[model samples]
Target: MNTSKRLEQALKKLYTAFHHNKLNPECCKQCAVGNILDNTDNWKYLSDSHGALELNYIGKVHQALGRKFNGYTPLELLKIERVFLNACNYKLPLHYKNEKPKNPTDKDVLFNGLNEVVKFLCYLDNISNVMDYTKLFEFENDKPKYKLVFTN
Candidate 1:
């Protein structure tokens, strides 16, 4: 599969963050978009609030100028954050009264968030979801449709 340079880089960063235990839903610098943007929290300024799809004044300027951070526009970063937060069961716009996971750092919770973020990223690049494995379960005429092979 030929993935775009941006998608490849973003996926690598996300994978590293996930393995390093740096992926966090509540922290702007450790969230999905943050990791993709080199673990910087500056992307947070693109929006007035966390998980908001609307861009603030600064964000609008960047969007209008076609400025991209790590190959993603300011609005794209906000959308990525929103998708991540939503998949992690975080209430939008992150507030005190919003519903959130009791253990936000749990592996399962983070994995769920990463799964959706990856899907969204792939969607943006018009590619297949890298994390999808359901095709391995496909069967034809009571026979396994896809073979799992290990190469050394």
Candidate 2:
């Protein structure tokens, strides 16, 4: 019902989706843990590696995924993956380290936060449409260009 719980539900669903599906690339383990712990979306880094992901990796991600789903281009799968991953990582955590909370939070705040993450996961599990967009890259001078995926 609250923000924290929502975050938790989203995260749990994300973890489940990742486990059930097969998107394999090295990820930031600590960040993933932090994401789950803090109920935040941290997957933007994977898709938007400051243009690095586009230059070096997005193609392979698309190719690998294309093989899994028929009638869908790698790009479509990519768009979905990007959105889903970002959803898994979104607005769950609003503060960085050394930042102060505007309002006081209790010791059990994180525990309650996990509830939302769980709910999100459940919702994701039930949905037939996971993500609607995949390709976040464009072309410039016949070369690869980075496109930001923002469907939130």
Worst 10 residues of 2 by lDDT: 22-31
What local lDDT does model 2 show for residue 43? Answer: 32
In model 2, the number of clashes is 22
TM-score for each predicted model, relative to the true structure: 0.93, 0.27
Off by over 4 Å in 1: 141-143, 147-152
For candidate 1, write residues 1-152 as lDDT tens digits: 78999999999999999999999999888999889989889998888899999999999999999999989999889989999999999988998799999999899999999999999999999999989999889999999998987769
Strongest candidate by TM-score:
1
In order, candidate lDDTs are 0.93, 0.36
Give a tens-digit lDDT track for model 2, residues 84-135.
3333333212224423323222223322323333433445445422232333
lDDT: which candidate is best?
Answer: 1
True-vs-predicted CA distance for residue 21, candidate 2, Å: 27
